[model samples]
Target: MEDESGIFARESAYLERYVQLGIASGRVISVSFPAAPEDDAEPDHPLLERVVAYLEGERDDFEDVTVALTVPTAHRTVLEATRAIPYGEQVSVERLARTAGLDADSDDDRNVVRDALASNPAPLLIPDHRVRDGPSAAPPEVEQRLRSLEGL
Candidate 1:
């Protein structure tokens, strides 16, 4: 498991909601901080607990065992990481914010991008389907929300 400190833990409320609702989505798992403290003795947050359990395969029946999607810290941009797609690699606004170093936890900013994507559509040349959650490859809706972030 990666350290949560250096990784700048994204609030990811939608991800929590999706996971709570049993929505399966992929993710880009990266170990940003390898030397951070471990809280394995007791999970502090529900999402943290779920993430730990999921990574350990304790929740196998509830989610997929294979990690199909992943992006390392080495790849600065999602589009840069997904160069193999050839064409139609939609870069969401949220990704832009993350690239520009914005607050990923802000609902208002996230919604702004979502609204822009829903309204304009073409600037988002890459398909939302490509943006995985972490390593598990979350559902389309999760990726859609990610790609819909504002000012990407």
Candidate 2:
């Protein structure tokens, strides 16, 4: 795992990716990065493969993956808009509010988008990294990794 410079590089293996994705009713519910290593075998899910590939620097929109919104109805609307953010692109929370048909000028409207991203259950699938401002979808390190992978 050491680079030519002799510094250890972060691994992106399927298991080492260590992104915990939760699902129910055949839909993704949550995605999180834990400090501990995964214990059990990798779950038998096609999206897991795609996610691994994405972590390895592949470009995947993940738009085809279905996710169940755990947020409120209005917040779900913001998440719905979040899903439209293209791969390798970044948008501010205010722009996301406007995309969700919320008044960008209203702090309340922007807050809704912020809150939705903050509580985003399915981070990678929802591509919360594509959204800037307010809360982040993944941890600071993971978020930077994702951005680097996307060349953002």
Candidate 3:
């Protein structure tokens, strides 16, 4: 497990650390940091190593890891665009909507983007933190730490 230092070290209402891997694809789906730590958590998983490397700032990108997400059809484009955002980069909701081929000027599209990010099932894997105007599903401090890791 990665050291819970800096922003991660602090206790938050949502700080639950656990790894969820896809059964069929054998890929990491979500790595949550909830308030209370779990006892007897699984310690050895290949994907956990990668996730640790990421949180510890030892890795720059998660492109090699496949993520499992069940986004609604309306929100799929926004999530896909968010997933495409590179490590350390940030984009506004309008820009993200444009990247997803949605109308950048349409409030509906921007709201869709925001809603998608706010409800992201796979937080770190999809990197909704990279979206500037969109609401983050992860804790704000965690998001800031991730941005700092990327030097964004």
Alpha-carbon local distance difference test for all models: 0.33, 0.74, 0.68
Of the candidates shown, which would achieve the greatest TM-score relative to the real structure? 2
Top candidate (lDDT) = 2
As a whole number from 0 to 100, the lDDT of residue 48 in candidate 3 is 57
Q: Which tens-of-lDDT digit does each residue in 62-106 have in candidate 3?
A: 676665567787687788788889887899888999999889899
lDDT string, candidate 2, 12-78, tens digits: 4533456666665666767787754356425545666677788877788887777778678889998
- Cα-based RMSD of the predictions, in order? 16.3, 8.6, 6.4
User: If scored against the real structure, what TM-score would every candidate get?
Assistant: 0.23, 0.84, 0.78
Q: Write the per-residue lDDT of candidate 1 for residues 66-111, one digit (tens) a residue.
A: 2223333322233332322223244445564465344557776555
> After best superposition, candidate 2 residue 8: deviation in angstroms?
27
Q: Is candidate 1 or candidate 2 better by TM-score?
A: 2
Which portions of model 3 show Cα errors greater than 4 Å? 1-29, 38-40
TM-score: model 1 vs. ground truth: 0.23
Q: What is the lDDT of residue 24 in candidate 1?
A: 25
Candidate order (lDDT): 2, 3, 1
